[model samples]
Target: MEHSMFCYQCEQAMGGKGCTKYGVCGKSPEISNLQDLIIYQLKGIACYAKPLLEKGEHIDKEIVKFVENALFTTLTNVNFDLDFHLEMLKESQQVKETLRNKAPHGNYPEAATYNLSATKEEMIRDAVIAGVMYEVDLDPDIRSLRSTVLYGLKGISAYGHQARYIGHHSDQVDQFYFIALEAINNNNLTLEELIQMAMRAGDMSVEVMSVLDEANTTRYENPSPQKVNVNIKKGPFIIVSGHDLRDLELLLQQTEGKGINIYTHGEMLPAHGYPGLRKYKHLIGNFGSAWQNQQQEFDGIPGCILMTTNCLMKPRDTYKDRLYVTNVVGWDGIKKIELKEDNTKDFTEIIDKAIELGGFEKNEKEKEILVGFGHHETLSHADTIIKAVKDGKIRHFFVIGGCDGAKPGRNYFTEFAEKVPDDCVILTLACGKYRFNKLEFGTVAGLPRLLDIGQCNDAYSAVRIATALADAFETDVNSLPLTIVLSWYEQKAVADLLALLSLGIKGMYLGPTLPAFISPNVLQYLVDTFDIKPISTADDDLRNSLQQAN
Candidate 1:
């Protein structure tokens, strides 16, 4: 009789409503229940950790990691194993209990006092009461805002997970994780107060993303212009996917001179530009295309497939045996490449598998793609870019970026990028660039027409570029001749969108579909307040954005 696994946190929910029985992403009722319980336990950890943070006391590092992982695990299509979530949930509860007991004695919330269930049946019963859906407010508008804030936090937590991996941590960002979670539990707040809370979460996203950017650049060097080969070379190789550069680095270092080549896939394609990473000669060109096409492209692939983070789909039977995952990515039966406590991973078995498979035979018609146009590279030619703007040669800048999905309307991104006038420049990041990254967009005043900003974590770099450009022109970011047309298919996009809204950047376009979690009143509020529009036809959107810039 209880809610049968209700979830509306993403764009691909069933019928544009809650997925009440099973997730459209292939998550079952059991997995959804475990994910909900994981959140319930995370709230308790926040209850204890938040106050210690406020009083300038150190909350244990392990607790922070648990919270970050718990939230990130619930991201769409990231994990499908119920047992993994249960084990993590059990560990999360232990951490929560230890923190509650060790804290300087003060009143604890109900979340802190609650005990995790010992069995699957009891856990499901408890989740019906503890899940986010249980917080149904009398005011539909307030409920809508709270749901938005929770989704935003999920995205922030994901970014933080990646940041912490690269040794970047921010006290402010850590503190807000608890503050935002606690805010979602407070039901008495007025509608206006909830709106303010959503904006505050947005502000936190900027700080979180900045930490990730620093972590990546400091360890991997600033990205610069580099040519990436799109054609697969002959011989045994490994196709590295997802956004973890460190994982890629380890594989590249381990596979050197072993007669096995490593190729980037999806978000890893941008790694070729980092001087430190590109130095490895064996780290060859990218394989296949976007994430959505993997089921087909990876079918009977002759190399090993390793996914380092989110955006992993259900691997097809043809290649599932050869595929591997690590760093918080897990599927039901696929093998996970394990890392030691010291952060070292053993990819030797994977290497052996690649050799056994014996990759594709040589193709004489090798193709090349260009990438590595991060902030440093883009701004290296700042004078020329600025002068082009002043000379009216470059009329507009369109920031078209976000995750790629198999949704019907995603073609809008490809068409939109293709049709942008020669006088305009396109800045892109994440897998969304795959929609058109292969296309040749020649130079304008000695600058490439399209710039590949690093992975999704490099959204921080995009903001930095915009801020610097605004400063150069002596105008605010919103006042600059820039338009944001985003394609979002996951939680990270939600966090990035909030970061933009927090900056008061207005009139952005979002698609292939609006989040199912944003209720009617909340959608109306976003429209009235920020002028956020659901995308229309590619031609209409291009014309409108250009006209606005003019």
Candidate 2:
């Protein structure tokens, strides 16, 4: 028997289990199954690529890039274009064949040797059964562990994709794509071995994030604390959303002095702190809140919107005509900007649209928020932080950030951030910060009580800050008087959690809900080993965090 589609890879899985007919992210079962087919082929490609790389054979860089792009595309809310998905499915099969012929022959799993059916109709049927639920009879715990590693890789691949976009490449990080991808298809692996692989994926998460962090800083300069304007300036304008700093930089350059004001939206809000980007006088303030609010936030805005990466919503008709996507982001009807043969984008179309629209006719009331507290920027004032902690002025550090969704319990994060004590410092990143970043938390010891740590992938910066603080105090991260309260929406947050867990950092709080793929036993394993808690009421969780744990 074949199923329509089954995906529990996100926080909002239908009924907190799986999306059977349609994805909550607006992915139809056809596209959903096709994405699984692509992922299935990615594993098959990895079987060859992994062994060949281990044997010191060269693999084409495109295969690696394709894998990363594939994982990112399948990430919730990134791609819903049926045709583009079909193209990716075909490419995956091609890549698998290319890799299969290059590898030395050996015993391999069904995934490694699986062949595409002769007809498109047969292929779709096979893909229907090749989804996340393919190994239906596998142990529930193994399935959970395997999905964790797979989702973590998807998260790592998002970073790897971004890292490579900015000329950063890591052989080990690239190799792990194969190592972990191939492992997921092997049902014979024990739970312990799967855990080890999960940790390795975490280690790779940290590495790829470091690669991206270096790539971003080297290209855009290290971020410094700056008050970014949050109101609209009356002029022709364009909004850049998503996590690609490179896209924002290019858009900044293109829109400069053209009488078009560029506004950062969603995750792109932190670009205002980069000296290179901030130097552009016309790079206006942010326009909206988180990605989840886009349909309402961008309603009939008289400007162009460029979605450069993930976290995109299905565009509404009111603004879809003005919506443009580049690279791997896609929706069926929106215009797309592709890189020229030289790997550079010509945003002339988007710029022209901004001019034609003659944006907001009048200026809105001005507002500002502080941003740009990445690892280096935050660590620069380490003396202040350490001294504050030592003197007991800054009582506790709460890391409250992750992806923001339209889910109801999200108010807990808002309330949590709002209720955090005056003496505590809140370090945050991602659109999840939007829930509380607008509120005034004031300054503590010359540092803003709320420290903005850039995009979701900037979890590396958060990790670095934690590690440096631990070293400064001569203790492990868990030993520090720090509490991590996170809200996860997608695979990237999964990778971030894996990174933290791999470093042996425990006693963390995770919400708005647990991922549906984690079975009760697997969740218990995580709970017992890592002490990971599903978030309770903000007040109770905060009270418990303050009164109880070490």
Overall lDDT per candidate, in order of appearance: 0.85, 0.89
Q: lDDT tens string, model 1, 278-383? A: 9999887998888888899999988899998887888899999899999788999999988798987999989999999988888547788788988888888888
Which stretches of candidate 2 lie above 4 Å from their native place?
Answer: 1-3, 118-120
**Span of 10 residues, lowest total lDDT, candidate 2:** 115-124
Candidate 1 positional error at 203, Å = 1.9
Q: How well does model 2 score by local distance difference test?
A: 0.89
Model 1, C-alpha of 22: deviation from truth (Å): 1.7
What is the clash count of model 2? 0
